[model samples]
Target: MRVGVLTGGGDCPGLNAVIRAVTKSLIGQGQCEVMGIEDGFQGLMEASPRVRELTWDQVSGILHRGGTILGTSNSANPLRDDATKALVSRNAKALGLDVLVVIGGDGTMSLAHGLADVGLHCVGVPKTIDNDIAHCERSFGFDTAVATVTDALHRIESTANSHHRVMIVETMGRHAGWIALEAGLAGGADIIVLPEIDYDIAAIALRCRERELRQRYTIICIGEGAKESGASLTVRERVEGSPDPVRLGGVAHVLRERLQPHLKSEVRATVLGHLQRGGDPTPFDRVLATRFGHRAAQLVLAREWGRMVTLQHGEIGSVALGDVANAQRTVPLDHELITTALDIGISLGR
Candidate 1:
């Protein structure tokens, strides 16, 4: 059997690990051939698709690297245009690819599901720093991102203490607060804010004021998507024609400006933007990516087309692509972590 592999959506750590594992596992079997697809679905949309053979030698020594050896594009969606879809179909048939190991997040999976409907076999390996893919308890790249955010918070805390200031650190979480919530708890944040829960500026100001008398320093971890109660999300900008267009950002600054009037201490905001997305995969993420890759290979070998590899309740498994497509696993308001944060006296800005 011949297989194709591509990484789509935003680039993140552990992506190279997945590429290496998928290529090496299939090649080691000695019965399968693997090809690396360039620039995601955009490659296939080309009149002459960009592709190359993935020999065992090529995939070596990439496990420790960040990002994918196979290139990616977030804006390329063959499903949107019939002409592009036809071109992709023709290209796939011409290349004689039996299946594609698509590694990406929710938008990528949605594209994979649509491609499957047009007669291209696909197997998905969830990849996102947000850890918001439906049916998967955790996805690769999240651990590394969380570690980055936590480290940033640790570094920010020292300065915050020295200045006796209110430092607000913003993390990337377009729709979910997993990164902010987890990293805040790990880094001993005084207040943790999430997109899942509404936040009141007055409540946050009150908390900061209380800290001023005792702690004299306040550390807040806020998700990018977080906003004031009855307010719309803070959008950085919208990309026309992109699958996920709305870019959330600047909430930390918004929060800072709102709290500055009520708090005596100086308030500052730090946006940990793409810093969380680029880095070597953490040990946990490397292992998880390898596991997901192997599972994807198993599904492909078993002819389980249109399925996505998933990690549920500590076990690796597979779920239909349709189930994950267009769906997100947002953090629940009543989640155990939220309860833990509340019990520990961490203000959620509610």
Candidate 2:
């Protein structure tokens, strides 16, 4: 069987590891041929699609790399129109691919499901730094992001302490607060705000004022999707031709602006934009991505088309692509982590 592989949606740290594992595992079999689909599903829509054969040598030395060698485009969605879908199907058939191994987040999985609807077989591997994919307890790239955010917070805390000021750090999380919540606790943040919980600026200011009585400085970690009480999410901008276009950002700056009036110390805002996305994958992500990739290849060999590899409760498994397509997993309000933070005297901006 011939298989095509592509990385889609926002590029993450473990993408190269997954690509490397998939190519090596399949090519080693000798019975299966692996092909690389360039620029994601957009490649399959082209009249002369961008592609290449994946040999063992081509995938060598990429396990510790940061991004996909095959390239990716988040803005291009091949399932946007009927003509585009037909073109994609025709191109995939012309390429002689029996199945596609799609590596991506929710948007890319949705595209894979659409391609399956058009009679093209696909297997999915979840890839997202946000760790918001449904049915999967953990996704690759999230560990690296959390590490980056935590490191940044540690650095920011020193500066805030030196200046005796309030510092707000914003992290990437459009709908879920896993990055902000986990990194905040790990970095020793005094306060944390998430999209799941509405934040009261006055309450945050009260905490900052109380801290000024003792520590004289406060560190706040907030998700990009977090909002003030009775207010909508802060949007950076909107992309015209993408599946999920509402860009969430600037909540830390919003928090700084609202909190400055109530606190005596100067307030500052820092946005860890894309710093969480770039850089090499952590050791945990490397192993997890490899496991997910090998599992996906197993599914392909077992003829488990229309399924996505998942990691749930420490087990590697598979779920239907239809079950995960366009689905999102957000942080629960009663999560143990939330309870831990509260019990540790961390303010949640409630």
Which pairs clash in model 1? none
Q: Write the per-residue lDDT of candidate 1 for residues 1-350, one digit (tens) a residue.
A: 99999999999899988988888888775368999999888889888999999888898899999988888898888887788788899999999999999999999999999997678999999999999999999999999999999999999999999999999999997999999999999999999999999899989899999999998999999999998999889999988778888888999999988889998999999999999999899999999999998888888888999999999989999999999999999999889999999999999997
Error in Å for residue 83 of model 2: 0.9
lDDT of 2: 0.92
- Per-residue lDDT, model 1, residue 73, is 92
TM-score of each: 0.98, 0.99
| Alpha carbon RMSD to native, model 2 | 0.9
Off by over 4 Å in 1: none
For model 2, give the 10-residue run with minimal summed lDDT: 23-32
